[model samples]
Target: MNSLTIALDVMGGDKGPHITINAAILAINKEPRLHLFLCGDKSIITKYLLEHHIREHPQLTIIPTTETVAMDEKPSSALRNKRDSSMRKALDLVEQGKAQACVSAGNTGALFAMAYCVLKTLPGVERPALISALPTHKENKNVFMLDLGANVFCEANILYQFGLMGSVIAEQVDGITKPRVALLNMGEEDIKGSDHIKLAATKLSANKYINYVGFIEGNDIFTNKTDVIVCDGFVGNVALKTCEGVAQLVYRKLDRFLSEHFFARIIGKMLAPALKKLFKSMNPDQYNGASLIGLRGIVVKSHGNASAKAFEAAIFEAIKEVEQQVPEKITIALEQGLIEETHTE
Candidate 1:
């Protein structure tokens, strides 16, 4: 329980206000000091809140709005057409200093588009990047990788900015001091990746504030070798999806194998306790929130299909970022050591 309020776009998720409202209840229950501004269609959201016996709860506030950004809506249309959307209004709460952060399980492109147009980037940030705290090599540890499809085409300076922003998140949230950062590459040598990555690696290496570990191949992403991996949106998004896909495949195959084979089922029952722990640790729901870092205010994107439990995890992520004041940490880090943009203007 902390003295912070979080804005939630209750209309944006796959299940609409049901999931988001439930998540708001779950989060507020868990954190007694937390307050929520649940922004969306007032009548609908209020109905759900009343059904849940929370319509007049002191900790929750409902901001009335009429429209929502469609999942398939073009970014241009969302930005221009939907001025009063729940997603936009939730962000507006933070921009107007009514809330500390905003969380939405809405259109990705629209969120990115709206957030930038609304909050703008922090000082010295060329652009905001999509970052996620991915569960990595060690238990309870995560790697903050960025530019996760926020900008498909990033310049060398933009990539460098990712390292700085990633560094702040890793240090502030993950508690990793001087987090080991690396440039994703086809090979471990300097003669790898596009010129953008190479140039970014060079700049990061020269910066004393960051612990740049040169280039690491794709496999190294899951290893303990690095805490932050910098790359353009195209590569980061592909790597993120590929890893999630493989994880889902492994879980499915294990379940099928256990069910199909009698011997394995017996063994699985015996190992059920340990296997359960493993499964919980590897659950994608545990990592449901992905921070759209580098913005002036905090904004988290939740998985569209997230359940109440999964969406609760995302709310907690927003809470942690707010409690830690991650955006402020990034600002201080930039002011202390704003690297020169070496790439061509």
Candidate 2:
């Protein structure tokens, strides 16, 4: 395969361009066929590159943008006031076909607002949905969930669209032939959940393409029983944050307990490799880079607090989607469904 081009929004993350430059260098070293166009203040990026002794690599290009979207800035204000922002410039590369994908560890609201205006959506999509892979109990696998705080007021039909978008994502990214789709709900029974969720379930069950595996509760998301879980942004965001909080609490307690006792400390040393492996597998950073799925071109949103390793994962994510042609897959699926299935309308 030819080298894939990825645009990096260096100024958006909480850690700023230094971390982005480090991550990009790591990504380029790992993937020989990867080319990066770093968009930010030219001098800062150049200083980092020279300090890291990688000033003139053939795989890197720097696109300077004068403005940056602040972490606390409102999305609408960022859109109206910061037209020349790095986030917007990186997105412009995708729209102009200069790059295959763009990765930003920036403000989610700003990314979505700019992306909606710039690249628009894939055919038949009401709007783009934010989705990320979650590590599951199955070991070495992750569950793809959507609407992680993008559209808080999604309708029954919009939720169904999330199912379709998520279905394509799981299939392409995880190689699931027919991903087991489920609606996030209060109970597993058909009678549970709000009317919107129930309606979406009904829609998914009738759609021949989706696996539609009944309904799954919050506790079931990290299990292998379901492959793709769909929910409105409000509920999905809460469920995601709760899981993250609980995981952090458990890890800290285990670390503190191991540190307090001498015999326990010795045992921990003996089991250090296994424990380290287990914790690495469960770290949320391993699952960074939630794609703003359904965009006309690929756009990935990395967590603002991502470390170098986590941010590199985000770049790899964009590469994977570009290779698998996810946007094309979703577009073809939607176009065919619209033509052959009149019941959809």
Whose lDDT is greatest here? 2
All candidates: TM-score? 0.94, 0.95
Query: In candidate 1, what are the lDDT values of residues 289-325, reduced to their tens digit?
Result: 7889888899998887778887888889888998899
Worst 10 residues of 2 by lDDT: 278-287
lDDT, candidate 2, 267-339, per-residue tens: 8788778765665545453446788988899999888888888889899989999999999999987775555
Task: Candidate 1: give the clashing pairs.
Answer: none
Q: How close is candidate 1 to the true structure, as a TM-score?
A: 0.94
**What number of clashing residue pairs does each candidate have, in the order they appear?**
0, 0
| Residue 253 miss distance in model 1 (angstroms) | 1.6
Alpha-carbon runs more than 4 Å astray in model 2: 270-287, 339-345
